[model samples]
Target: MVEDETDQVTLDLEQFEETKKEDTKPTLGDIFTDRVESLMKHRDIDNVLDDQQHILNNLEMMNEKLKFLNLISQSRYEASVTAFRFHMRLLSGVKKDLDSVFRRIRTLKTKLGVQYPEIMAEVQDKYTVHVSDDDDDE
Candidate 1:
């Protein structure tokens, strides 16, 4: 009876050890599948990062182009303003010259009327004749 009890205890201990080992064992197929899934996830993350980086680079390039265009527009505006100012100055000078010429003509007409009244009258008559001739032609 004692020997039979010892054999039964040894058999139970062996069975317990086998159950523990079975629980700890992972299948080769499960390990391989897990590794493949991990690799796919890593590749997806890498692709996403690459796409983000590409978009950022394009945006940076576009920003630079916009800045360049803005500078060009500002320069063109300044040039246009300068040209307008120059034209205004030229017009002012022309006005002054016209005024001077008109003054000179008026002075000459007054002097001629005082010094040579008969000559001025003859000139005025000739001017009226020329105007009448031009009106008939029209």
Candidate 2:
């Protein structure tokens, strides 16, 4: 009976050891899979660097495009300024011509006043064109 008890106790210890190993230890397949996942993460470093480089290249392209746009805008502004100055000079010359013409008409009206006084006032009022000079350039 003592021998039988000792055998039974040994069998129970063996069963308990098997159960503890199954419950507490990882399988070889699970360990290998975890190692492969760690290697894949290490390999993805290059992919992460490539992604950053691509983003930087795109940013450089956008910066170049913005520089081109700025150049175009500046040129347009310069052309507009040149055109405005040309128009201003042309208008100033036109104003001078108009002033001379008005002076000549007034002289003619004064000369004809002695010959026909009645028509002088009518011609002065009808033919004189008054232009206002409100230019910012003094």
Candidate 3:
């Protein structure tokens, strides 16, 4: 009958549609995105991002140092640089002796203050500089 033939035709059309969907090629955007994702994974893009972030942090630190140097006078800059170097040396010495049971944090800070009395004062002065600038009328 014609109804049976129509039903058969409809079933054939449905099967054809399913096959068409399955056989369709991916679009250009899909292929490009997939390739990029695969390349990023293969090249360890996460490590690259971490390295770039570290580099950015170093650059930011250097920028802050340059800004601080620009803000202060040359003599003060030199003094602060020297103090920072000495502070680092002191910290290194403390680190070396940290394993000893007798070394206390407060004791180390007290010794540093005694040896470089002006060091903490200079650090406080550096932090206060911005505050003073903000308070100025200009």
Best by lDDT: 1
Task: Tell me the number of clashing residue pairs for each predicted model.
Answer: 0, 0, 0
Off by over 4 Å in 3: 1-25, 74-138
For residues 1-138, what per-residue lDDT tens digits would candidate 2 score against the true structure?
Answer: 999999999999999989997888788997999898887876597898999999999999999999999999999999999999999999999999998999998797678998888787787688986666875532
Lowest lDDT block of 10, candidate 2: 129-138
For each candidate in turn, the TM-score is: 0.46, 0.47, 0.35
Judge candidate 2 against the unseen true structure and give its global Cα lDDT, from 0 to 1.
0.90
Candidate closest to the true structure, highest TM-score: 2
Candidate 2 residue pairs in clash (backbone atoms < 3 Å): none
Instruction: Kindly indicate the candidate among 1 and 2 with the higher TM-score.
Output: 2
Compose the digit string of candidate 1's lDDT tens values, residues 1-138.
999999999999999989987888668987998898877887797899999999999999999999999999999999999999999999999989998999999899999999999999999888854345446332
| lDDT tens digits by residue: candidate 3, 1-138 | 999999999999999989987999889997999999976785588789899999999999999999888777777889989999999999989867874535576587678878898996786577754536557442
Q: What is the lDDT of residue 68 in candidate 1?
A: 100
